[model samples]
Target: MRHLLLSTAALLAAALPVLAQEAATALPETIVTATRVPTALERVPASITIITRQQIEERGHATLAEALSAVPGLRLAPSGGPGQQASVFLRGNSSRSVLVLLDGVPLNDPSEANGAFNFGNDLLFDVERIEVLRGPASSLYGSAAVGGVVNLVTRRAASRPFAPYGELAGGTQGTVRGGLGATGTIGAFDYLASANGLRTDGFNATARRFRNTLNERDGLQAGALALRLGWTPMEGTRVEGTLRYRQNRFDLDSVPRDDPNSTGDDRRLMGQLRAETRLLDGLWTTGFRVAFTQDRRAYVNLPDARSTASTRDHYRGERLGFDWGNTLRLPGLGFATDGALNFGVTHAREEVFSLAGNTPFQTRVNAAQDSTAGHIALQYRLWNRMDVTAGLRHDAVGSFTGATTWRAGVVYHVPELGARLRASGGSGFNAPSLFQRFGTIGTAFRGNPNLRPERSLGYELGGELDLPLFGRPDFATLGATWFQSRVRDLIIFQGTSVANVDRANLQGVELTLAVRPAPWLSAELGWTITDATDARTRRPLPRRPEHVISATARLTPLPGLVIAPQLQFTGRSPEGPFASYRDDGTSFTTERRNKTGTLFNITASYVVREGITAFVEGRNLGNSRWEPVNGFQTPGRSLLVGTRFGF
Candidate 1:
């Protein structure tokens, strides 16, 4: 795997000059996640990836996992099938260390194992774009950002009076999906509304390579609705609000047991209201936002098909958050003219409730916590060539000690060489989840209230170069980065209770290249090498692959036809004989290693008319039987066909 990645990097470097065209155009992509403000991508001083709506449509990506798999310095592990449990690891950090946001609202579930966001059932029907930041961002976002952040931006209203769109798709395994949406602007108000649904008969989630279960086929049924409204009351004043809801139900299989009468259901609701105004004749701007979210889950276990449920469990989680901020533009100081000051205050409250019945140990648990935070940031440009940014934040939790975080970054540009040098360093922390602090299920597992928050310090240095081909507007870009992080006070489980007992260190290098050789063709390649280990035991982290590579190419064969091929490679990595307890009450651990694996996918789309389009996709083309989990089976080959209409 190492040789393959190194060879691919060399090939991309050697082919850059030969593929250059005569275009010298600059790519001006605006991103807001890097610094909590809209900033040009080239000057952000951080590693970020933007997946646009056009790319999503062309690639036929239906879910967030599929769209994010092509990014560097990231890895995903799925239990099995669609709508199944999945975990994302960024830069070798724990799955719970990454923060997920929907239009600036946090989406983590307080009742989950570690308050992580499940991407399994998150569809992309009304999404406009996705931004992924690849490093710590605790200075801007409060907690759960020790690794990175993923922000999903929903589609906005169009300029026209009204526009409507719809799609229908079907595939193998009894799969069917559909969606409808409308967006438009009327007078001083703009609105967008959308709904989507999916149903599929999936394979058994616990099927293993050497053993097959007798359980019936697990299936999934899901639906979602989203609405957004905005009003422009005056020249510099605006009010906006959003509402989103989703529900999913799926069959389940008990680990190490063939249980066919088990099932689960999940539902989520989120809403936000925001207002913005400019003051002092456009010299200052201020904004305020409030958001609320709720998550509910239910599980049932039946001993027989004709018998009543043997056991049932219910869980609910809720969060309320408020934020207010202002930014002021300052006059030139010394050699810097583009100067600004930013400050913000935030407050959040979280609660979790759990109930169980028809079991040996029926129990109920309820917990809540609140936090308040304040932050300040500064930005300046020197000689119109160097950009600098710095920020500091302090948080006060209901019971824990106060925590503080800080970050600083710089970006320098060289016009003659068409290159930029950037570097950033920051501190991050993750507050303990409700489940870890107070949860208890029967007498099997217990939570400790004395657990401390996990903390980390990380830094990165990188550079980017843009090269024009044939003096035309076509160009190619190459970027490379080196990053390292050290974490302390890690939390883990001991016996039946959770505790802080581990520490870790992770370091990695990432290389990426994007080329548009001609108007009809474009390609991208990325490679990442990571070294993650336990700080105390000096052992490799479980499931942290040493090398990863991804590549994609899009071609326009005809006037309205597009074809794209994508490839992803995961290198051999270590797995665990995760700790487990037998029915007889004996505890033990297991160990193993996972083999290297690769996947290839292809998609094609054609515009049939002015407002109609058709598409087809093939996934897992090679029929690879690799397992992302230690004892689970991954899907083989599958195909889907779809059509879309716009008016």
Candidate 2:
């Protein structure tokens, strides 16, 4: 790992002379997650990554986890096969520290252990883009933003009167997928709607040596739907609404019984209504939004093939949220110009219910909580060459003392040098979840009502250089960031109850380079070095690799054709306390070191005509048997072929 890091540094040093001779250009695209406003990527004082729809298609990424794994400073840990539980860790932070949003609305399940968003079932259907903002962002997004935020933007109505699209695909493991969508604008109204379905006869989720290995495949089936509508009744005023729903069913391995008849179902529904208007000649922009979401999950277990009845467990969670916000273009102060102020108030209520059925330890539980928050932010351009942003927020959770968070950042650009320097610092917190506070399931687990919210303080500094190469219009970008965070009251499961019993400190460095030597070719390289430890025990955090790297190259060898190859490397790390169930009905914990592994994937796509395209993708070409989690097994090489058509 050290040698690899040195090699990467040397590569950057070798390119400096060529970069110094180049001219500056505009940033790649605009992003909204950094400040809740559309701003140029180079001007945002944060470590961020933007994945567009084209990128998604080019890579043939089917899940959010696949798409996000390539981003710098992010780690993904999948427990088993498709539809199984998965976790996303950013900068060595806990999965619960990262907040996920669908179309700007929070998607975390309040009934989950720590209010984490499970990416296992989050498909890419109708997703237009993804924006990942790294580091603490609670000053703007409130709870669960201790690590960062991942915002998914769905497809919107097209500018033309009407447009239709569809796709069909099939692959190994008896996989089949299909999707269709339409978008259009008509007079004062615009609308977009899409639907997708997928099914696969997946491989066994556990290793052959595991006691639960039934030698039976764990299959999955899923369906999703989305609809978005907008109306412009008058000038500078718009009303918009969105609806999304998804359902999935998958087979699982019962650890104790080693039965193949365990199955699980998950369903999610979301809706939002928003109104925005520009008053006072566009100087003041205001909006109000109301949103609701429901997440339901159920599991059934059949002890034997001849069993006529089954044991079941169910959980349901719902949230209702309201927000009103406005952004005002303020007059300049002294030498500063283009000043703006943003303020918003938010209120949300969450409820959860759980049932453990038909057993001696059966239990029924219900919990609810409400929160209100207010936030304000200010941005100003100073000296015509620097941008500064600051924000503060206060939240009052039910029956808990108020918590306050704040953030400030600066971006300084030297146009002539084609360089920029950025820095930011913030405080963040995660409120206890309903499941952790008041829910209980059978005799295996219990809740603690006195638990407190987890808190953190973090900061980052980075620099970017945009360089023109070879006297052509092609350019390259190189960036480096260093960050550190300290978290207090870290939550963990002790025996049968959850508690905040530890503290942690994490620090890391991320390096990224993107190059486009010509219109036909592009390449990217990203590397992350993390040092995460328990403040009390000084032990390395579990499942967090000290080094991670990813690289990709996209080549257009022929007209309307693209071939892309990608490589990902995860360095050796600690793994342990793995529970291994024995045939005697006993279980024990064991600790072991995980081996480093590398994966390779490739995709090729070609445009067949003006409105048609075809693609094929191959994943895990090396067929490595690496397990992200100690007891589970990962799939081997697989292939998929697909086609898309538009009208």
Which candidate achieves the best lDDT against the true structure? 2
Most accurate candidate by TM-score: 2
Count backbone clashes in candidate 2.
0
lDDT of 1 by residue, 1-647 (tens): 33554554456445544444332436779988888767888878789999998899889888888898888999887767677777888998999999999999999998886878787778899999999999988988878999999999999899888999879999988889899999999989999999998898977666444343564577899899999999998888999999999998988765544468888899999999999999999778899999999999999887785445588889899999999988888899889977888899999999999887655566566999999999999888899889899999988766865679888999988765566778999999898888888888688777888888889999988777677765544467777777889998898988988888899998887888888888898999998888888999888888788888999999997998999899989887777565232333233476556778899999999999988999998888898877666545566687889998877
lDDT of each candidate versus the true structure: 0.84, 0.85
lDDT of 2 at 615: 93
Relative to the true structure, candidate 1 has a C-alpha RMSD (angstroms) of: 3.6
Off by over 4 Å in 2: 1-21, 209-212, 254-258, 305-310, 357-364, 441-446, 579-590
Candidate 2: tens digits of C-alpha lDDT, residues 406-460: 9999999877767777899999999988878876657777888888889999998
Worst-scoring 10-residue span by lDDT in model 2: 578-587
As a TM-score, model 1 comes out at: 0.93
C-alpha TM-score for every candidate:
0.93, 0.94
